[model samples]
Target: MSTAKDPGKGAEKAHGKPSAKTPAKPAEGLPAKILSKILPPAEAPKEPGEEEGEVPHRETAPAEHGPGPDLRRLTEIARALNSEPELRHLLDLILDRIVDITGAERAFLILRNPEGKLEVRASRSLDREEVKKPTAKVSRSILVQAEKSGRPVLTTNATQDPRFAGSDSVAYMKLRAVVCIPMIMRGRSVGLLYLDHRFEEGAFQGVDLGLLEAFGAQAAIALENARLLQENRVRQAELERSKEKVEELNRVLREKVRRQSAELDQVKQVLRERHGEMKLKYAYPEMIGRSRRHLDLLRLLDRVIDTQVTVLIHGESGSGKELVARAIHYQGARKDAPFVSENCSAIPETLLESELFGYMRGAFTGADRDRKGLFEQASGGTLFLDEIGDMPPEMQSKLLRVLESGKVRPVGGKDLISVNVRVLAASHQDLRKLVEAGRFREDLFYRLAVITVEVPPLRDRREDVPLLVERFLDAFAAESGGPRREVAEEAMALLSDYDWPGNVRELRNEVFRACALSEKVILTEILSPQIRERAVPRSLPARLDDRPLKDLVRDSVEFVERRAIQEALARTQWVKTETARILGISRPTLDAKIQQYGLEKQG
Candidate 1:
């Protein structure tokens, strides 16, 4: 239904109803008849004193072809453009204008398709069948003039023009004059708005073209916005996939650690039962020592196979507490299962629970879906909790429950699912003292203390210094694909002498430093200066010639190595983490060495 005033008013005025008269000049090439119908009728002079020469305002500028109407009309158009955001609503308004002004009896707004053909996007007095009939493509001839000239085009007869083929279905409705206005953007017309006159009284006037050109401009803007929005949506979807990959990486790291831990436990027990000289064949026992302190740790590992009780491994920060944990899990019954690990102190308390137990969909506003907690992901595997002392107090209760009941309850979920898993806990804190001071839970402490294994510091097992250094050098060479770098006998001795506060972790870093900066075969000033400058337990040798150079270097290296190992062990609780840190190796490496050296069986 038309919303504007009836066009019957035009007929009444033409039939000599006392309407106002107009005397406006039409633009070049515009028919004077167009100016007559579109311009407002001039009114009689109000009084003799009034300015008589002033031309009456032509709200619909039939002559100028400028923007039609005045501020109020433009404002209304702008409001409509703003209020109706959807493209469908905007299309409806445009087609209605074409039918009302250009006298199109039945009209449609066709859009270009992916194949570059026209398809009717919306219509007036038309259904999908009429649109999809395949003839809906506007005649190429009709589009040529306006597209080439960048102006309005008029066709007097539809049957004559080759664009609208005369067919039985199309012939039923009369199509006379077509007034096509180019839809222009960036000075180029992208599409067309067309109208037809089905009756003699409905011929298009110049004012109709002016109105259509403005509407066409508006329609183009709406369409461009819709296309850009779709592109952005596609890009956002791609970014989400990349985020999922990072989550996958984190999951894989935990799974690897769990599997290795369970395997170590198995290896530990097998050695005890067979006991043929109790010679251990840990992954990397070749480059090293023949010390009873070093070998005892391996013996203890053999005794503790099949035990899922808490194992609190203590050592200095650089000590291989984490390494021992790995060895225990990897060599144990859970070898086939996941060896998941959590760095208790890394994540904040606020996020720790959600990260550990997972969350339900809508657990919090931005959570779009439910997630599997880490505990569930590591079910039937060993969970290595590192930095256990640093865990938030609030989460401690939950940890205790899981250990006691072997079940995990994710946040925002009701079901308490049982997990067949072993817990391997490690920390640098003195849990006994912490418990006495009411800082740590005594009950939780007892549960984890079931099979406590103290790792001996590196200083106590000076016999392993030569072994650790040799292993580190080879490992670095293999991984870097670079020729192996070695330490001078003197540099080795100096390294072993310092009281290493940073422990085995410090040793690994120093070795990496030597590898990173070592230009010559032997790491000299670039490496030795660091170890040489630090305070040695014994005074510095006065001259290299005083003792056998090899012995002198070995003593220096062992002294520093022992001191560093001792510091790390104290920090970690006599854990092989000290050796792991000294060698700049992984916890699993240290664990394997701990068993090989038999440190676990040492007094």
Candidate 2:
């Protein structure tokens, strides 16, 4: 018996002669050098006992009636095996082809795992159906011998052969015609090809072993190629998943940056608003008056000062509405622009249009050259229109159009001029009443009164009277270049007690007159007669005889209570909390007293 050699090394001779070459066409799809190693040349000399075109049968096995191995079929099978790249499918293909070529009852392709353990990768029967429980069908002893020696193990009759007689699988299954070929790659056994026939002793011959050894070499290469391709596919899938994760992270980062930028811009805007508020609080010293009403007006002015909304100032004549307008113009964003003022009542109806919107040079009686009007002059600044309630109905319509369109047509000019002016209108008369009586256009009134600022008259904030008096006294001294005159206590009391009907203007005029006449101290004698009349002490009731003692006492108590509550209300500026605190009473009790005494806050 001849020993089996490694299929990858070379094919060995059987029975002391070279194995007869299978006569068929040349192979394809493999390199010629590799094909030469796997297939015998067609022109080789025939064996002595072998006839032309006939396979030689060995002495240990009976002669077969089957034809010789077909070279063309083997080449086709090699091409088919190499073309398959998927590992699982290629393994089944290898086993199926082995069963067909060797005429074995069953075939198994066993491979080594990463841990170097033998595993049955595929199994096929002669019927071309898959065999289950392939591990039980394979001979473990044969597989070990083939792998260790790195050679093919062939037994014509495994049960009788001493080499495999002690194998449990061979004894139990009575295996015969067994062959185990080691699939070697790069001089290392990667796995083994196992085939067996259970019934016949010479089912596989020397000719079959030679053909299988050659086929095994091609199969090993195919198996290695398939395993590498599968690994590459798994790695490619992992890379795609990683790329998507990176893109998602970048998107989240961009969104976070955008939100942070917006929040920063909001913080900057808040800081700017706070800065503007600080400027309003300390910048205007002439706003004058610490009364709650005056403070409330200042707050309202601060709110509207930075905005470009039209403001309508509502107050009685000489209450200083124009002063409030000037404060807004000078202390606001448009402080660098011009401030133009006009009195709608002062200009006559015939000349008002030309005064407000300038006429073209040759269009009027005394026209000399084109002149810009108040609206044009006040561009990019503030325009104060005093006594707007007295504006004629026709002129009011034109003013409303200009204010809405932001463009005004001059008296005789054909083109409409655009003006970026912020308008502030003032009126002592109530525009609401004028609108109701049809003396003013309702639409125009609403348009002008986008924001309304009410300037309190001097009488409403009587607590400011002392401060105003001191200011006026200082002004008179500065103007006359004389020693500053001081008013007597009684005279100041009389001035505070008497309500000034003509408001601050009348008060200033009276102070000026007193300062002019007095030498060092201003007294009641120098004050106006109307103010002096209030200085006369009120006389007590001449007779208390008509009412009972208890009744009279009750009446006096009520009068004192009423006076006390009234004084408290005035001192606290009608703020119930302060009024109650000063009177040492609860808020509910103070409210009750105020209601009972018919005490109401005066405007």
Candidate 3:
């Protein structure tokens, strides 16, 4: 935010008439001393086709005669970004670091102003007076040219060049020799942060150009943080205003006139607590079991509360990996921090890295700027990586590295950032099998398996079904925000006895369907038909009916498999893992059954 004025002066006109003369210098000039102090010291700009050598700041040399000290300063820069406020100040720090990192003659962050003109938001080269002067409204200029090119636009002799002498921006800024690189993100150039040579002349080498690009990434992140912080502050102010109004209404209604009455204070505290919960909404859907199985789960949850040891909950799809993950996160020690959950199988392999680790400005072809990835967002709390077995092999390698180093390097990033967080990974698949097949990494498996808690399927935990049914009835009733409903005892018995192939997940959808379809208070036979034929041991059914045992066993397995697949398909709405979980089966097993039965949705 230098306040330097334009340096170029127009020649005196004869008879005070307008002529083809240079622009006139304003009367009051901002001093270089003021500009230099405010503007960050920058690296000199490199010429086109420059070498890839890093630039070091002169001021930094005294403090960092060694590499260790220089790196420490960069770490300090990262910590600084987390707390820094003013956009101008941050931009100044960033631009200065870029200059220091690249050894540029001068550096500046030229942001696209609202009018679509590039304005010097922060400049290190100009005096306060030169920066203070208003810039001409030049339509897309060489600045745009440099952006489109995606490489440094080098000029050995600026004044001699046809474009330089006539350009008002160049003339005003007094560009002698310049090298500019566009700051790019997600397929578009946002602005420019580059250096040019005003002290010495010659095109910048390739090495110098590469170094500047590295700085460009750091700059984008710092800029993004500043913008987000400002937005968050505005939102916070709005919330505070709303809260005050609510408090005023409460004060009037209660007619309480005390500094802090006990009842009022309790209500106020509850209100304060609710504000935090409002930020995070459950992305994971509800599970369907109110049966004896869930009673065991609740007991386990109660048992695990005191210790911070990692617990791995293994379960089939409808078995509720996410519900368990949520319970662990919300009731766990790091509940105050983010509970960032990522379904590893949901996104494509190619995009997963960028989604998980984030990317830098111009790291790839379309990267417009730096983006914060999930791992960074989930720091200081639990990161739930669902279906971890489904992650790609290459990504598994990256994941292992992060686990080992406790650090992440964003895609196209220059520095490795350390993070403190807990990792809670869940997969219904057998990791040992994946390793045997060379599909999943063994190293990653052990690293993630330090504590594993397997969630049993609905069929295994049949004793819990009655409880689950009751639980779902209430939960569904609350969700409807309508009159509560009940399940007929006969229908409830059928649900508990039926082998739940789709596990807890399938049970939920069934309840939802029954609730929506049934108008009466008690859900009847029509709503429970899909679950009527319960899977049981053939011998058990035979014993009841005095029938053949072998045939019953064969019939039972087929019926169970079919029900599980159907329920899974229903819960996941055709997603692979959901179907697998519903059946208390592995993804591969479910896929095989789907293919065998041709159960896939028709095109």
Per-model TM values vs. the true structure: 0.43, 0.45, 0.41
Q: What are the per-residue Cα lDDT tens digits for candidate 2 across 1-603?
A: 234334423322322233455445555444333334334433333455656654333212221221124456667777898899999899989988888777889889999889989999888888988788888988888888988876578887888888875789788887878888888777777789999888887677633444565577779889989988998998888888888888888889899998999889656644543344323452556766754467678888988898899999999887889989999999899999999999999999988888887788987888889988899999999999999998999999899999889998888889999999999999999999999999999999999999999998775555466678888998999999999998775676577655676778888999999999998889889998998885332222123645577545644554456557767877788899999999999998887566543445643
Reference-based TM-score, model 3: 0.41
Indicate whether candidate 1 or candidate 2 has the larger TM-score: 2
- Where is model 1 more than 4 Å wrong at Cα? 1-276, 281-290, 528-530, 535-603
Clashes of 3: 73
lDDT of candidate model 2 versus the reference: 0.75
Instruction: List residue ranges in candidate 3 displaced over 4 A.
Output: 1-311, 522-524, 534-603
1-603: candidate 3 lDDT, tens digit per residue: 000111111111111232243322211222222122112223223334545552221111011122223334444555565456778678777766665555566666687876986787776643321223323312234566677766445565455667555676766655655656666554456678656666665534322333344344445556676877888988999999999999998888676555347668646644543343322222223444322234346656655644555555566777778778777777777889999989999999989999999999999899998998888998888888998889999999999999889899999998998887778888888788889999998888888776677676776555456556667777888988876667665465466567677877687778777878777545446555556655332212223244367545644565465556655675676888766666677887666565433343411
* Deviation from truth (RMSD, Å), model 1: 25.6
Among these predictions, the greatest lDDT belongs to 2
lDDT of each: 0.61, 0.75, 0.60
